[model samples]
Target: MLGATSHIAGRVLPAVGRVPGNVVEAVASRPGRVAAAGEVARRFGARVHDGYDALLGDPEVDAVYVALPNSEHVTWALRALEAGKHVLVEKPMALSEQDCLRIGRAAGDLVVMEAYMYRFHPQQRKVVQLLGRGEEGCGEAEGRGEGEGGGIGELRVVRAAFAYPTPVEGNIRFDPALGGGATWDVGCYAFDVPLWAFGVEPCRVWARFHGDPVDLGAVAVLDFGDGRSAVLDYSLEYGPRAHYELQGTRGSISVRNAWTTPHEDGVITVVTLDGVREEVVPAADAYELQVAAFADAVRGRRESLVVPLDHSVRVARVGEALIRANAVGDWVDLTSR
Candidate 1:
């Protein structure tokens, strides 16, 4: 893994231990962070290095997990790809569409996946199934006829929100240069669900950002045209909350604990003309499932990736436009950008 000091790097190490044959053999950090990195190394039983470039040259390393700051995701991912190693970079893999596209060019033949573990959760798949799509499918596969909303009709909107209490001092989410902010950090996932659900890129978007280099929170609207839209709001300074509500003809589906819903089982409440029903999904280890999918791609067993680089590029485009909207305080034209 790259950057042992990242919080996400620490969060997933235990999940890595749960997956068989996916050993984390080495971790690297800056020279000043060696002590902390070494602590992680000792706890995880992996070798430690202050120089990331040196870790790339380790013959024992089969693949790399990049949990570095958002800005460095593409850089290290490309380097790992050039070194002939598969890579699983964290979400918002690249800060902008241009950089995301660059990473696409460098990811020739080697397995490169963005680590958005939520996409692997069974509840997300269940949401698709409820919308008349194949249960076992990719992130953005098209859905069939809209199922009756029960009481609501025609699926017209998807509302998603992801927020957390204020970040502590020194947290990377507050740094603009490091790809910090509410939109890049949590809003990306907010956009991901709607894009994946609608199966088409938003044709127009407008947003506003507040705070420092990045944003403390953002409220945006993504119009997919033809009466379809996604309204999303995300913040870094709020009580902990993550949820999404899908509205369609006949009824609406409300998923409590949507984005952060773990694999230990979760609920999806469907309110339709028929009645309100809460379906219980089986327990899942989202991170483990993501790792398994990455491993399958590396082993040539999977045909398509869940969070393809193209998806990253499109999302980055939307995010950049959002920032632009904030700068100009007007609705920016996405196609023009």
Candidate 2:
């Protein structure tokens, strides 16, 4: 694992322990963070490296999990690929679409994936099935007889909000240079749902922000043509609210605890003309599932990554459009660009 981030201990390291064929060969961080690295290594019974490059050179390690600041993602990911190590980097693969493409080009026959751990959860699997995708990546919608989506019919709009109180002081999210902002931080997750649901990129995008240098909060709209759209709002200064609602002709589905899933039991509520019902998804650690998937892909057991590089590129493109729209104060035409 790379970087001594807190979540690595709380989420990823434990996941490494639980998933079969996965182990923490070593933990590495920047200089002066040896104590932080030591804490993680001691707990998991792994070696500690003083810096990232040292960890990469270790022959015992096969894959590297990058949990560094967002700005540092592309550089290290590229370097790890060069070092002949499989990479599973965190989301917003890069700050720009061009950089995402760079990672894709460098990763030839090597397993490189964006770590959107929540996508591997069964709750999301249920959502995908409800939207008529057959048990895997967000490919073309399948024939479910009743129009398109199995339970929700033809999708019209997706409304999502993911927010929590992240203080301004010393918070990396508020740092402009570190690729810190509400849009890239939490909005990427929100954007994925709409993109996955529509199974296409938006024709037009518009947005507004609440902070300077970096966005503290943002509200945006994506136009997918044919009156289909996605409304999204994300913040780092608001009360906790993590959920999304998908509205369609036949019925609507509301997902609570959508992003930070497998923490507690997930709740998916579907409402249609027939009636209203709730599907309670048992809590399962998404990090472990993600680790297993990465292992499978590395061993050639899985054909592709759950969150492919192209999907990460798309997410970066949409994110860029939203930020540009906010800057220009108008809707940006994606097709023309």
Candidate 3:
């Protein structure tokens, strides 16, 4: 994996050990950080490479996990694919839709997947199942007898937000040239989770931005077809908070701490026609699950959880539209893309 010193990388290493067939083969980062790389290697008992190219050249490295900054995702992912390695890139896969498509096209025979780890969570599956049933007890009490629980087609409002204060002053997330911002950093989840749950793309988008250079906060609205809509709010200046709410005709589901909740013991609240039910979901290590899933896909054992590079491309397009809308203070139509 790239960016061995990142927070996500730290969490992922132990999880990699839990996967049945996985091994921590190597760690890579920029040169002049031998000490840092060595520390990671010592912890995981993996070899340390000073340069990414050196790590990529290793014939034994079958696949790569990229946890680099937002801008570098496409470049390094494309490079890994060119080197004949399966790739699992972190979220916001690319800065733009065009880049997502370009990287997808370059993958050739290798599997290229984006790492939205929460998708594999059992809580997410439960939410999907609960929504599939017709009931109304969570959000609106009067709608218990709604038709067919409104179906997946009846999804209406999706609200998602993720934010945390950035303590590192010179982190890549604070650099504009590196595609840094609250929207790209955490808002990608806000944008992607709804898309994943609803299985549809937005036809229109609008946004408002706060702060300068690296935006401190943003509020965006996405309009899907059939009167369905999603709202995404994100900020980097706030305390740690993450939540996702999905509303349907029958009921609604709410996920608290969706992004970085603990793996071993996590709970997601599901409200249905009966009442507010708290589902105790035993969390498997998400990083392990992600790596195992990617490995299975690489070995042709299973299909990816997030399918088609076009999905990431569409996410980028929607994010770009939000940026545009924020700049002009007007709604942006993304039907063309």
Among these predictions, the greatest lDDT belongs to 2
Candidate 2 at 262: error in angstroms?
4.1
lDDT tens digits by residue: candidate 1, 1-337: 8978788886677778777777879999876788889999998899998889989999999889998888888889989989988889998888788988888788787778888888787887777777766656547746422554234556689899988887468888888788788888888888887877777777778887778666899888988877888999999998477888888866787778765535357688999777888988887777777887887788887554778777778888888888888788887777664
Query: What ranking of all candidate models by TM-score puts the best one first?
Result: 2, 1, 3
Candidate 2 per-residue lDDT, tens place, 1-337, comes to 8885556446888888888778888999797798988988988999999989999999999999888889999999999999999999988789999999999999998899888877787788877777766667433333321344447778889899988888788877889999999999888988887887776888999999998878989999999988789999999988588789889888998988865545688889999888999988889888888888889999996554777777788899999999999999999999986
Off-target runs (Cα >4 Å) in candidate 1 are: 143-153, 261-264
> Per-candidate TM vs. native?
0.93, 0.95, 0.90
Q: Once model 1 is optimally superposed onto the true structure by TM-score, how far is the C-alpha of residue 206 displaced, in angstroms?
A: 1.2
lDDT of 2: 0.84
* Model 3 weakest lDDT span, ten residues long: 136-145
TM-score of 1: 0.93
lDDT of 2 at 332: 96
- Count of steric clashes across candidates, in order: 19, 0, 4
Better of 2 and 3 by TM-score: 2
Top-down lDDT ranking:
2, 1, 3
Report RMSD (Å) for each prediction in the order shown.
2.1, 2.0, 4.6
Stretches > 4 Å off in candidate 3: 133-153
Between candidates 2 and 3, which one is better according to lDDT?
2
Clashing pairs in 2: none
